[model samples]
Target: MKKNQSKISIKDIAQELGLSITTISFIINKKAKNRISDEVIQKVEAYIEKVGYKPNSAAQSLRTGKTKTIVFMVEDISDPFFSSVAKEMEKLAFDSGYKIIFCSTDNKKSRAIELISMFKDRQVDAYIITPPEDFQDEIEQLVSENQIVMLFDRFYRDADYNYVVLNNYGSTKRAVEYLKNQGFKNIAYVGLKTELSTLTDRFDGYKEAVREANRENLSLLISFDDVKSEVGNKQFEEFLELHPEIDAILFATNNLAITGLKILKKKNIQIPEDIGVITFDDRDLFELHAPAITVMSQPITSLAKEVISGTLKLLKRKHSIQDKIQIVLDGELIVRKSS
Candidate 1:
């Protein structure tokens, strides 16, 4: 209670409680390997409060060689699909005694690389990435160094790593099949243009549906790599103008689907009545819109669990486990007025 007291330290708390600073450190950080008595721990903690002692996370991390943190790098954090996945992953990581930080690249390759370098220097415990462009080389290097890097929602062409993704091919095929059954003669597909395995798989499903329909009479319009609102909306508008008779559009992701809605609204196009809409992932805005939008929602919780468990398994391995699991969870189609 002095007028100008200096900053408190572990030494001060230890001196006041008649214990060594090492004991106080172990008890406070819950690293009491020898099972320090409850009474001693309580006394140290109480004295810590009395002296206003605080532990420095940097120092603790240096001593333990563990940040106890995981990082998730995604194309766009604002995108409904990534946002949902981030929330679930954070919750699961926290429950398992780890923290998670989300890094959004906006689908930029350079940005993703910068974050990868930064996280590496910071010694993050693990990473889950939806990489940009040809970052598989970078990811492979990390994996070779025994870093825990799990691919989520996407897969690399020549790299072997853990991944949790939805069954993109089957889901999109089902969506297109549904539209065809509803008498939609002109079906279009909209999504980002990337070598990303997920988008490619979904695009394959769209192609399969077209080929299986055996309808040379039906029209198919495919749009790709529409990331931003302005770009996406403009492209969608141009497509609609060029093909005025398109009956249904299948979006590869929720962000593209949202942009499609904006363009359709501006053009005064009626849903299902004029142009049917079905998006890949669901969000709150989709449910609250004028006519609730339908979605093919991924199993976010299951995906998170799978990735986290896989990372833990990797961390426990003597060498990289050759059990490369490409888990393909299902996406549910939520039908609404738009479809």
Candidate 2:
């Protein structure tokens, strides 16, 4: 250690390594691989490491306009599915020298709009959002401004936005078809009523499959907030009572299935005997139930990886719709005894 160089700067490092300030800056910021020789790059890196020189990130970001931060907005951070995906993304982002700021949108338009404004104020490098309804304009504006935006979990079908999402329609259709193949009839889809494309697609899949089999497309839908309320529980019970012929049920989400399971358990309804059950999204409770539940298991890690990669890719491009990336992944239908 040089006693006099206690407060070393980029200028000091540049002078000591006999490299120009621009050269040192390029190397430090990982932007010199093509222009700088490997030997020189290694030497500069070694010197920087030995001197423990850390660039002033605030100043660097001012010059480069990069925060190396990604804001990930989900429907609900407390939900198992969103949290699990976030855990995977956090590590991947850190490894790539970026950090994630997680925010829960709760499927609210105003909240999402507020978050987007915050992202601008904070100079967030990129946005990976699971958006709610009625905010397509905000997204479009961001895209027009040459900002990095990656939509995940759900996206607008009509909009040419960068996104990675599950094949909700296909997966749900397959699950219902599987149940029908196993001799379960009069299957009813229990789903949340929503305009969100993903949820709508899931219901559409269930409807199409049921109709194809020369059966009535029976379904029960409730508000998203009603899933946990007393009103929601009553709707499930009454819906079952109204249609005793419904021998099998496809719950659109884990939360809905959990509520339905409780009602069934209270009534001593034996699964697969009185009624078969299947749901989207696997949970630990589903795996450990009295009769383990059947599920359409989403690729959480794959979703995370794709979003991170897509966000980074978007950052490099013009950040317009023309260069947008789209990914559609499949969910595994894990059959268990409950179905």
Candidate 3:
């Protein structure tokens, strides 16, 4: 009743109402539909509301074997794409009576594995991951144990896991084609050096477009570990200097684009004049830039909805779902002055 008082418990409610704890629990767990009378249910409900008694989640998890918690593993939580998607997913999951724990893999396989094991130890109900390369064995093990798993943003081609992804290849291809149409002759791609399918597809898309146009493929791949470092900036500047013929650049990820943009600015390279630019993932900073960056925007809202819905379906069905689900959503190419 006090401002800083401890939370009221089911036992307290039972004691107050002169009812057994079992009866209170059955009602609280919504298992009294036909077995319990309406009068007793109404009394219990009224008393619960009056006292604001809350059931212990840990105890409930033990009794029901459902923790109602999900782990969302991503490469970088601070990235706008992942963070935006996370916010939406968290809201949806919370509304559906589940909580989400976001963990950044930092594009490290070892870190991802450790987080996966930790979440497993916590008995999380489900997992939504943007997995790193060579981590299929751990995911496969989770699947084998009948754990609900949903891959998002990226996934392994060989693994049969439920996933929600963007059309990486097609989007990047279109972006390149658009740049070509804008009369940019030599377009180069700056991408992360990781083996993520998302980055690979984008790179492949760039290659396809360049090959089709009879233009030489000019691309630079930076290691993920060095992506945010000054060394990456130097590498990108060197790549640009080495390929003077490259009049345009397509960055594979938002971070790469941000880095490239800074380097370009430092060198006084005018966008759309000296080097046209288009990024894969959209960010607010991109839109607010001088020339306003063009980008292949992933459907963050749709991705969140589908991922959460898919995760919920798996959690509800538990081991009943045999076939893996894969949903690939389209990305929109937002044309801006930079391109």
C-alpha lDDT score of every prediction, in listed order: 0.80, 0.90, 0.89
Cα deviation of 171, candidate 3, in Å: 0.6
> Which runs in model 3 stand beyond 4 Å of their true positions?
1-12
TM-scores vs. true structure, each candidate? 0.84, 0.92, 0.95
lDDT tens digits, residue span 219-262, model 3: 99999878889899889989988988889999998888888998
Name the best candidate (by lDDT): 2
Residue 261 displacement in candidate 2 (angstroms) = 0.8
Q: Write model 2 residue lDDT over 149-239, tens digit each, in one string.
A: 8888889979888899999999999999998999988999999889888899999999999899988888999999899999999999999
| TM-score order of candidates, top first | 3, 2, 1
The lDDT, on a scale of 0 to 1, for candidate 2 is 0.90
Worst 10 residues of 3 by lDDT: 1-10
Q: Write the per-residue lDDT of candidate 1 for residues 1-339, one digit (tens) a residue.
A: 332224666787778788888898898788875678888888877766666666776877898877888889998887767887788878888887889889898667799988988998999988888888778888888888878888988887566678888899999999998888888888888766667788889888888898899743232223445455466566667777878778888988776777778878888998879988888888889899878887888888888888888777766672644787668888888888887
Score candidate 3 by lDDT.
0.89
Off by over 4 Å in 2: 1-6, 14-20, 31-44, 319-323
